[model samples]
Target: MVAGEPFRMLVDPLATGHCDQWLDLPETSRAGDAAALLDLLFGTDDTLDLVVLRVGTVRHGTASRRLLRGGAKGIDDAAGQTLPGHPRYELIDWRCPVCQTLVWRIHADPRRPPECPEGCGPMGMRRTG
Candidate 1:
């Protein structure tokens, strides 16, 4: 998937949260470029409270379904240890650049950051309170 293409993201919150959130790919980067996507999402953080369940282009809902199935297979392969819900794991919180929405807390370990729930694009690191 390329940048600007509609993509869905499946995410699980840090603490006792279930269900997946579908979001578009950030305008600034392409989906095939995992590094750029990760940087856009996570910023400088190395860890994240939310875990990426799956990411894929949106085309007649087939891509998302395929990704979901793959994610499920991965979970099964992990011996059911990598379930969607996990306990609280704190990370630095960031605010959305456009809407000022509080984004998910992220760890110092690099990973994909959460997009704005408002569909504003990938969130940037909040510089101030």
Candidate 2:
């Protein structure tokens, strides 16, 4: 690497650069990272066992599932306890089976998943956390 060398910017924000959208641009930053947001799970969707934890992050981007952490007593259980008295914030997770594409967001009733950029058809819900 050298000074003034071109590089990749992970997320698109109030930013102008070559965006390396290897992952989807983050929707919110102050809303908290995925783990912190897990508090939304409790009492919202009891059937949802999905959990996501952040192993690392930069630029509010990077959605690699391989880097995710927390589950069961880790992120999952803690979610129910943390943010005491906080109301539910329904979230959802969708994955593209063919390309391993992943995404998550605040969910609305009966909204369908977005089409895969890889042209793999509609992504399916893996779960929510």
Candidate 3:
């Protein structure tokens, strides 16, 4: 590198910029259709054992196979919960699959999973640092 010398790094705007197809824009963040949302909210339509435990026992009642759609607000509320020492729970906003409505809030706890507001089932989670 020389003093006052111009250096350039080749970068593809579409691949590196905000316009990247893989980058989910704010407007296009929602799942393409309700079916996808349902899949995300609940694992699958098929019945299976789903559980969240504090130690070795179930924390909340098991969610029976059902469909829940509507009251996006309720779902949002269910998503956010307060912990003793942790920072305020942050959730990704999403559109309800059953209702196609905006959800301002939603979260999932590793120790205690969130119940489906519309009775869809239980919300899944991913570990965040």
| Model 2: pairs clashing at backbone N, Cα or C within 3 Å | none
Q: Write model 2 residue lDDT over 29-88, tens digit each, in one string.
A: 322334444344423435433333221133343322222232322344333444543444
Worst 10 residues of 2 by lDDT: 3-12
Q: What are the lDDT figures for the candidates, one per model?
A: 0.37, 0.39, 0.26
Best candidate, lDDT: 2
Please state every model's RMSD to the true fold in angstroms. Answer: 10.9, 11.4, 20.4
lDDT per residue for candidate 3 within 1-129, as digits (tens), equals 221111001111122212100111122222221122332334432442221101122111222223222222223333223222234323444333443322223233233443334445544433321
- Residue 79, candidate 3: C-alpha displacement in angstroms: 6.4
lDDT of 3: 0.26
- Candidate 3 lands at a TM-score of 0.18
lDDT per residue (tens digit) for residues 83-122 in model 1: 2222322335566778766643424324576666667888
Off by over 4 Å in 1: 1-88, 106-110, 127-129
* TM-score of each predicted structure versus truth: 0.28, 0.34, 0.18
Supply the global lDDT for candidate 1.
0.37
lDDT of 1 at 60: 16
